[model samples]
Target: MILYDEIKTLSDKYEERLKSQIEKRVSEMDGDDLSHHILYQVLGVTSEEGHDIDVYQNKGRFLYKYAGSFLEEAAKLCIKSKFPDSATTRVDNTLGVRPKKFEIDMLVPDGNAIEIKWRDATTDGDHITKEHTRLRVIHAAGYKPVRVMFYYPNRTQAQKIQKVLQDLYNALDGYYYYGDSAWDFIREYTSVDLYKILEKIAEVKTGGK
Candidate 1:
């Protein structure tokens, strides 16, 4: 329960940071960033519409960043509550030359190496190559590679990449969990129902309860 309170405080802090940053950006946009409207006008988008678009996009960037970070930190807290000695670790990429090392999000002493992601929405095909090498490195390091992704990709190409990654994980005898499954995996393994607590917090914050 104390950990849940910590997550709630973290959510508030992130929300405040988001609001302050957005306000600063919007104010700066009033005089300095308006030149982008010329290009938008050439593309037939009005200045008013362009300004709205920029604001929306800017807000989206911050929201996504904060959301991802909050979930990861919260998940870490939940996991640490169960695995007191678990920690984030770096393992050398023995199978590759370019990537020096791979960062494992959570490494329990029992050899479960977790890679946490809020989402993987990249359409880049090379993401697979990088991930393959990383998993291979983790596997070679005598650790079981596990992926716990809170959200799945929405676009078709991104989904396809995720599918391939899932297959790769399976091939390497690793574990993969996405969306609801990722949350459940944490709950089952850590004995902490983070998803439920998060839902309750959201309801209370948004006055939707």
Candidate 2:
């Protein structure tokens, strides 16, 4: 299968694992919070489906949907890791005054953020440019942001995909995606273990701290 399909498949599996963990955590809690319910629903784990409809057209909507899924998993992991049994953990709470207009792939508390982008031939350059723009804005606003480019099928002939990513990082002032470092950040921020972070997050909610 193609890389996108592969990633999607893995994401699905990851979601299942995440769901289990979340359910277990909630079982231990005294009362349910709206933020927790919102997160659970957003990640597609909850049975309830509110206002099921499409907002964006074509692939744009699909991209946002997947990106949001990834971000929710990351946020859940981060909250569990940092707070564990703490009842005051606010995973979905916005830290800054900025409105939640953009779809951030993954985000961490204390201003650490990640924006994930997937590129095919049709919109690779556009995606890269947009990421750069967003990075600049975040940097200028004094927030630590990380850009993650997950290229599927690996068909770009101009240069290696890693090189392309490197060049993009080099062009940016404070953005970087060094080998394994990006994954490391993903792991740390998401609180999900490395081996099945993506896949498990897409599958069941495994027990986590």
Candidate 3:
């Protein structure tokens, strides 16, 4: 229960900060020049000479990609913020032999897999396709206690996704993580307050100088 409360509080804080940051950025952008699809392209847009794409610069490099990297960075930052020396726990820096192409978003010291997703619950087809394949691979390879974490901006969206997963997947017996249920599963395995870490990471990235 404590973990769930902490998770809810952190989710609330991060979402509030993210919403404000997005509003601020939108206000600064030239709305008249923005197109409908352009507004929707949070992941990334291809680099073409005459594509009329919006280019942003940071640290002398073109900051073209968003969404996935942004979410991943935030997740990594949260882990670092909590573990400090979590660099070694991450599988990204290490490589090993595998039968097929696979990547773990975050790996705990106990060998648990964490997959993070933030998208439209109604349209995102990952649960049936990529996620199923990834879990099957991990299980076949003898990986224990894998987790799929879905990050929504609010409780309503999170619940909707939870229902969708429940309705669609018979294979997902106890692998999906969202909101309080996720917090419970995470706390059962580790004492780390993942939700609080997420909240802190969001605050630092969106509001920090």
Q: Pick the candidate with the highest TM-score.
A: 1
| Cα lDDT of model 2 by residue, 1-209, tens digit | 23334454556665565555545544544343445456657778562432122112223444555555564454344444554442221122133334334454444556545555443333356555554555555655555665554433345552354456556555554455433654565466545444354554345445442
Q: How far is candidate 3 from the true structure (C-alpha RMSD, Å)?
A: 10.7
- Per model, state how many residue pairs clash: 0, 28, 0
Question: Which has the better TM-score: candidate 1, or candidate 2?
Answer: 1
What value does the lDDT take at residue 135 in candidate 3?
58
Q: What is the lDDT of residue 50 in candidate 1?
A: 88
For model 1 the TM-score comes to 0.93
Order of quality (lDDT): 1, 3, 2
**Residue 87 CA displacement from its true place in model 2, Å:** 17
For candidate 1, write residues 69-105 as lDDT tens digits: 8889889988899999999998887887787888999
Q: Put down candidate 3 lDDT per residue, 77-105, tens digits, no spaces.
A: 45544554344222221123442467766
In candidate 1, where is summed lDDT lowest over 10 consecutive residues? 28-37
After superposition, candidate 1 runs with Cα above 4 Å error? 38-44
Cα RMSD to the true fold for all candidates: 1.7, 14.9, 10.7
Which of candidates 1 and 2 reaches a greater lDDT? Answer: 1
